[model samples]
Target: MSDTATRPEGRRVDRTSAPQQGSWTTARIVKLVAILAAVVVLLVLPLYVEEFWLRTGFAVFAAIIGALGLNLLVGTTGQLSLAHAFFLAVGAVTYTYVSGTSGGTANAYGGLEWPPLVGMVLGVLVSGLAGIIFSPIAARLRGIYLGIASLGLVFIGQHVLNTWTSVTGGFNGRLVPAFSLFGFSFGGTDSPELVIAGVPFGQTERLWYLGLALCVVACWFANNLVRSRPGRALQTLRDSEVAASVMGVDVRSYKARAFLVSSMYAGMAGVLYALSIGSVAPDSFGLALSVQFLAMIVLGGLGSVTGAILGATFVSSAPLVLQQYAGSLPFIVDPGQPGIVASQAAAFLYGGAIVLVVMFEPGGLAGLARRLRPTTRAPGAAIAADGADSSQHSTPAPADPSTGGDNR
Candidate 1:
């Protein structure tokens, strides 16, 4: 009797001594709460912030949307892309050409005047169509092959925009009228304009809201996608193409779908970019721009959408912010006419960041955030902490199966 009583007490005591496994971990409940909080903040943010910051925030959102799209197709689907920026150009040019056109021949990619809506639709559709056509090649290639193939599209896109002077206005690009919704131009100076205290929201702020709206839609869709049958099929290919094929997953079709989805998102993003600037220049969508997009996806992590957004935000903002600050720094080189510190330095830093993130963290900002999360006796923390411990005893992959599959 004494032994039985003592044993039971001891067991209870031991259980009490140990921490709850899920208690400190990040739960789906916590994530939902955090997301809700973020949304609330975003809504309230524009109300209090100035026009410039509003634009800045919106730019971040646009980049996030585009990067999130890339993460889905490339991160989960394991496709390499280098022509996303060109797709962006397509969107910008298409939107502008459409807005400024007289129902007759509006300028298009190669100077084929098209109707506005038609031009926008055609631009996006053409990009998607290109994805399908390029799929067979994407199917045959991996790594550098896909990259090289995509690079060719960059030059082709540049040539099309440059040579098709009638449509793209050759090297000059085109001016775009403000994007309107429901008869209200986003930032128009007219009565329906977005104004607060006599300061109307500029093109950037208006475009930002447009971008945010699109981002919400994109994220919602992507969230559903990675959880659905199609998303599962994508992961099946990423992990083991042979296994996926053996399972009757049409790998070629999946890869093509990834490209198509990514391009579509890029196309939409281009619209916002053009609207924000109120103009489009061929130089804005150059080969270097494509490389930057690649760097964004890579640094953000291949398959994580949140990571993609974070990466895009940083990539897009870092340079401009740095250049502004660099000007105040003493002994900085005048990169401008007698200018010392130039935007070029920002690009160099961005490149260096890419290398460091790739070689060292691989998971980028998302990974860093995960690492910094306290593992204080929580549920998900157990796995994270377990893996952290296991990392010392065994070599582990940079991403977990769960996170690696998250498209957004």
Candidate 2:
């Protein structure tokens, strides 16, 4: 009897102590190496790329930031919004009107002449405030109804941009002040020219670095947000608002906060967009812009920050690149040519892609990328990693009272 008991305990101990094989160590090293390689490539790219590509890259960065913001709202919170362009317009106009000097076409508009950095900060804040003001409506409405209500905001904002002549320069638009920080202007240098690695670092190059830095920060912050507690709440809310409420999530508050965060991101993107275009016009913040933003999140894989960046890059750069190579490509032509315009071609491509993504792969690019990854794991590896055994994880059966606490 004693030997039998000892044998059973010995077997249990041996099973618990058995070493498990895993590929996690190798997988982690591979992931680290890949990240380093990508960072190095991005860092060195500017040294060799031409000015046009650099300019396009900056625009893509701005788009990426905007897309990330929209993903937070529509993808994460499950709220439909078409007023993103309105917020962008608010940011661009605020930045321009605040930083720009007093003088314009017919001297009709006025400006505060604040520092560019200050203007950028104020622009983001104003956009966020606008979002907060609209949050009440967002909280009340759901689904497509909310989408339509938000759409109305875009039309209202466009009208405001057109009629606010003194502030917005009416219909002609206003010039965007070049971004500068502490006397370092991100514009053409007139005296003691700036140079880097025997190459002149002009406005485009400077803006490229600025955009790159902001993009990195935005991506990092978004990833963190997605993985944190609030992110989980948002995801739960998206899955089922009633369930989220049962789980103690303040649905209304979270929804409102999501709007504020998303709009703030749009505001930042707007500032960058103004810099990229060198002007802000009423026509630029129409319904078309909002649709493009929606397409970015949809095509990139909803709720994925990295997907947002990828989608933005493709959407924002495709048209510019196509236009640049229109003559070399077939069927695509210049803006006024008989054939397809670059913008039209890009729209057709993304529109088709959106339909395919929705119909076939609801997860979008991110989900598709995950599907290509290997899912198999070493046996018992998960249990070992979790530091739990089957017995520990499950409820114990009741012991027989007559058998000294033993079931058998």
Candidate 3:
């Protein structure tokens, strides 16, 4: 069968939702300006804020990283993995176990003491291992089956953490080592770096730079992958495996490679999360986190890297962002276990947010941006009904009677 079948109307199509091609050079410039503006805000934030804000900002950055990782798997590679928390946990627990005291903070020993960099490296590798080990599932399953199979990873990871006290520190969990960069033992826990001239920045501030740098790298990698021959193979696999095979694409190998690469990104994110939190609890990395990642891709819009970051930024901050309301509510300071009224209301609101996005903006933040700033279309030579410009080609057509055709 063909990659796609037409309905009553004839039109080329792919089952997946990817962006249609057209250079939005003008809009792209605006988008770049907006992105840089956001980065500038981040750079200047540490000077104006205390440690609390710095930590919160760092969390947002970490969440964005996680979301971006998940996006690589689901959004671009056409994989549906809801087990992202497994990688995050793998990173966190790996850092905790391999570091200093070698036990959970709640344990008598306190925790491990590997340098922060070492722990980060471990996290990345462990997370990637988790992904690599799960590669077989991606090779075999598709759509919902694949999603469910990957979802098992979260439960499996949780069970391992909760049961393996020797390594993961069981339920109580271990604290991450105080991050030491280049022999600077955190300088001062909160604000590691002091001002030399007119600049003031904290550890969290420094972390924002790291996080931004990593995210940029991830974006670039994903962009390159999608624009390369391998990316073309990936698209072919996504569009239709059988047809792709006919085109000499190794369908299984390509998908497996995609999964492996996607997992590497996830592993890196996990390491970043471990570094940011300095602790790893079995409860922190759970199915809920996986769901959150899934929701992020949906909210960001699949196949769009920039949109993934946007989704991750918002979703990761959702809890803290909702706390103002939690504090205002009667006897509901804790959102995780709020009063009956607040709990129900919060659940409804969360669901409502997802519903709103699916109903109105299927492409998520990217779609909204596109609407606000439509692409600049050139004159006369419009993209044909299928989004292809026909001006490049010439085809013979019979002349009409009014135009003195040969028949006439």
Candidate 4:
């Protein structure tokens, strides 16, 4: 039987919103298999990967979290912010003070020595509070103006971190207390001993898994948030604030919420960063860090969750990986050689990538992936996939011969 004949006359297919008739679509199966394969790979990676790679993976995970937060604010909400590093410093400093121990010859420093988990929670909360406090000013500015205003925050934060000797440990910075939960430490041998098929799990292996779990949770939450109602509202605001307000979206309120959520994510990232570096320094969170984050989202593609992850991996891992192989790579020079170092090399590479992506592929890696995916629609299917109403649609008339194929 013909499919068209089975349908009533004048009935539109509504292909954009209709459910798939097939039980096992090729796209669905591919997606399922890909996810399963990725999960399997992540599960066993710690067993085979070396410590250097494992540590690099942790750094990449931290960058992923930070990039995701920045993407939400800059890409999703259309806010150009350079103050992300300030919030990260806030979270890192808070975690250090809350979980650290008193030190120095004169006992000038102070710390509560609270549980690491409590410190992590407080880090997120304090970072969100900082965002909330800044939202009033953020709400008042837009575009380059807001970017300039946020730039000032980074300097102010740096000064505070440098001067706050008791809390921040002054310019030298403070050691980050090792994270532990329920008596199981993420560092040292206190982590439960385990032998899995002749492979002994150590601190590096344990931290790899920890980082994997957190990255998974961060990605999952970000994916869900971007597909929800609030995500749509933010996208609307990004495209046009006047239009969004006309559609009943509270512009200032939504902007504030976006900032709050983004900063909280940054807080989580900061905790991970502290753990990764084993210290929190005033110089660590600076304008350069903020620019690297911006580069991450830009390279990954704005408003694309997966692209952000890919970008973070590329940005975070490239320098460390390059430094590891600096002796072999032709153009890369060693740190003290005076030529372009691995970090600078990575910056140049991604900076060029940003320009190319902006010029040729604004969607970034995610857009490229979308273009590479196989099309699922059947041949001759007269259906739009963007939720357009077919009832009000019409086909264009045939071209006129006298107008030379142009519609006159």
Task: Give the TM-scores of the predictions, in the order they appear.
Answer: 0.79, 0.88, 0.79, 0.88
Error of 4 at 34 (Å): 1.2
Off-target runs (Cα >4 Å) in candidate 2 are: 1-29, 106-108, 189-192, 376-408
Worst 10 residues of 1 by lDDT: 3-12
User: Tens digits of per-residue lDDT for model 3 on 8-35?
Assistant: 3334455333334664555567878987
Looking at candidate 4, the ten consecutive residues that score lowest on lDDT are 1-10
lDDT tens per residue, model 2, 1-408:
232222322222224443445435556677779877976877767789999999999999899999999999999999999999999999999999999887657235668999999999999999999999999999999999999999999999989988998888878889898899888888744423688788877888889989988998998899999999999999999999999999999999999999999999999999999999988889898999999999998988999987898789888998999989989988899987787999999999899999999999988888888889887554456645554555456555667689999975
- The residue-level lDDT of candidate 1 at 377 comes to 60
Q: How much lDDT does each candidate structure score?
A: 0.72, 0.88, 0.71, 0.87
By descending lDDT, how would the candidates be arranged?
A: 2, 4, 1, 3
**Off by more than 4 A, model 1:** 1-26, 102-122, 191-204, 330-335, 338-342, 376-408
- Give candidate 2's whole-model lDDT: 0.88
Evaluated at residue 372, the lDDT of candidate 3 is 86
Clash count per candidate: 19, 0, 10, 0
Q: Candidate 1, residues 105-138: lDDT per residue as tens digits? A: 2334333434445656665776677677778898
